[model samples]
Target: MADERETRPQADRQLCGLVRDLASQIEAHLRTRAATLGLTPTQATALCELTHPMTLRELADRMSCEPSNITFVADRLEGQGYLERHPHPDDRRAKQLLLTPEGSELRGRLVELLSKDSPLAPLATEEQDGLRHLLTRALIR
Candidate 1:
């Protein structure tokens, strides 16, 4: 019985390994791209989330990270002239994040670099579409 169980094909293990390898490759590619932009991976991701203006808490939620982590990323990006903190139109104490001209330009370039044909792009369009569909289905649950 133990032998039968052990011999059963482990699709889950194989799929998990493939997913992990893909994720690692993406992380490495993004790290290289981030260095070229003078931004850390976290900072770049935060800026990506700011395609529209949002408050720090909102950004943190979108980033799925701690508020403090988002704050650190925001501070660094602001110092680099990639982001500006503006007074929240509705709240006296809260600040909204907006990209500077420099930030907008950088974000555009970043999008180009990470687009469908970029490193993260799958080898073929069909593969890319399939992965997207599968991942979307998985995420919806």
Candidate 2:
């Protein structure tokens, strides 16, 4: 118990470092998987976060990026016939982004690729759930 007390103060710093390392691994894995589909990392990330039709602002918030960056990514995806913009249901001036059939297909493939050999793959299902729970709790200010 004495040793545990001595180490407790350093645990938060160590945990933060581990989280950063995990994020880096996940980003690298995403980049590699995205490349196989001819997508830039940002575009792939946007699509992954777009599982439902949502406004640019909503998607941007989910992506933790400025709406302007998503605007450009949306344009590229639209030009490629992967997505379409529609007027939001109750908002007069906002547009919601929806996946086209091609976009849905690509998103499916991307999800499949992401699931394989992912950074959390080594964790058992329950352990993964525990980690997610802890992280979400940490985020709830």
Candidate 3:
């Protein structure tokens, strides 16, 4: 009763700290991995998430950024010949971003690098799954 209430705040603060530390480690890992492929973390993330052609608006939604932000990413990728923008078939007002062949190859290598030496590499498969489930459950609440 009173005992539980007294510890709950401390427990929550500790959990929040742990989560932040983990997030920092993961971001560092992503930065390192993306650098190996000559990409910024955001660019690498965009490339990896582009399984199919999508408009800037859609990419922004996936990357959790504003559509304007995605334009900069798309411009850099397009300049490097990693992707191209074509008029959207369904939307006359929007353009779809498609990965070039080179982009696909780069993304494959990027994925491989990202899969190795992950911040959570120490966790076993079941532990990772459990953590993911818990995180997902928490997010929904």
* Local distance difference test values of all predictions, in order: 0.84, 0.95, 0.94
Residues 1-141 of candidate 1 have per-residue lDDT tens digits of: 887677655766788788899888787777778778888899878877898989999999998988888888899899989999999999989999999999999998887676734654546778888888998897895
Using lDDT as the measure, name the better of candidate 1 and candidate 2: 2
Clashing pairs in 2: none
lDDT of 3 by residue, 32-115 (tens): 999988899999999988999999989999999999999999999999999999999988998999999999999899988988
- Residue pairs with backbone atoms closer than 3 Å in model 1 (clashes): none
Error of 1 at 66 (Å): 0.6
Q: Which pairs clash inside model 3?
A: none
Q: Tell me the deviation in Å of residue 77 in model 2.
A: 0.8
What TM-score goes with each of the models? 0.84, 0.93, 0.94
Deviating ranges (above 4 Å) for candidate 2: 1-6
Candidate 1 error regions (>4 Å): 1-9, 116-119, 123-126
Residue 43, model 3: Cα distance from true site in angstroms? 0.8
lDDT of 3 at 131: 100
Model 3 bad stretches (over 4 Å)? none
**Best-performing candidate as measured by lDDT:** 2
- State the local distance difference test value for candidate 3: 0.94
